[model samples]
Target: MKTVILIGAQGHMGQAAMTGLKKHNVITASRSGTGCDHTVDITSKASIKALFEKVGPFDAVVNTVGYCEYANFSEMTDEQWDTTIQSKMVGQINLVNVGLNYINNGGSFTLISGILNVKPIPMAIADATTSGAIDTFVQCVAHELPRQIRINVVNPTVLEEAWDVYGEMMPGFQPVPGALVGKAFERSVDGFITGKVIFVDA
Candidate 1:
């Protein structure tokens, strides 16, 4: 059985991934819940390092943590930008740096992006910018890692869970299920996908 460490393993998508990956030797890392075996703050490399220490080596590491704010670029605060960027972009880079040290050869690293980078909507400036940055990083960094380790990003559209808040605003746009996105994660890790951003809209 391949060992997999999942960050942000308590959120909606994370929970769905956990359910989908039940057959694997899965370990959960996050801020809360007894459901998660490890605790991590993605913005802090020290915390991430500590978790890897406890988990030891693994076949794959999946990061699904990132905070996003919906606001116009002119209205976005420096704090909001920093929070999302650190949580999504820089934090994912940190995961690669840390995970590379412990992953076995042919292991994979999967990070989450969102479709806003390609299909932008109003009030998504912070999210779109970070999403684009992550995809670029994956494409470039795939050649830099050792042991044939691969890196990929999954860009998902709005989830069905967001309907109450964001559905009406997006006329005719379909909301994909978080469970379906879990399958994208499976493909990125188990399939031969590297330096690519898999879009999860259907």
Candidate 2:
């Protein structure tokens, strides 16, 4: 089985991914610097570098971390924009860049985006922008990555477990189970396709 490094291993998506990736040798990480096998703050390049160093080589990297602000586009503050750009956009890419040397040849990188990029809501400016950026980034980077390292993103809809709080906010669209979304990440890690956005529709 392939060795996988899973960042953000304690979140909702991360826990779901862990279940799907159970067959593989999965290493879990969190930013709390406790409980998990490793700690990483994706927003900091230095922190990312250290995590990889401690962890060593791997066959795939799966990231289920990131957050975006929800607010009126007009009133969105600079801090909100920065938080999304720095953590969601830049942080995910940094994992690929800093992880190049640590991954085995033909290994894959699976980043998480959300369906918000396609079915945007009223206050999803930050989420939409960052999700869209990650899609473009993977498409662009896939062409130039050395060592045959693959990269892709999983765009999942609102999760079933989280529907209680978000159900009223998101109408019309059904919430997908996290396990169903985990299949997309499995495809990215185990399949040969790269630069594709695997959608988890509900």
Q: Each candidate: what lDDT? A: 0.86, 0.90
lDDT per residue, candidate 1, 52-93, as tens digits?
A: 899987999988888887788999999999899888889989
Q: What is the lDDT of residue 199 in candidate 2?
A: 87
List TM-score per model, in order: 0.93, 0.96
Expressed as tens digits, the lDDT of each residue in 100-156 for candidate 2 is 978899999999998888998889889999999999999889998898899999998
Determine which window of 10 residues in candidate 2 has minimal summed lDDT: 14-23
Error of 2 at 133 (Å): 0.3
Q: What is the lDDT of residue 34 in candidate 2?
A: 65
The 10-residue segment of model 1 with minimum total lDDT is 13-22
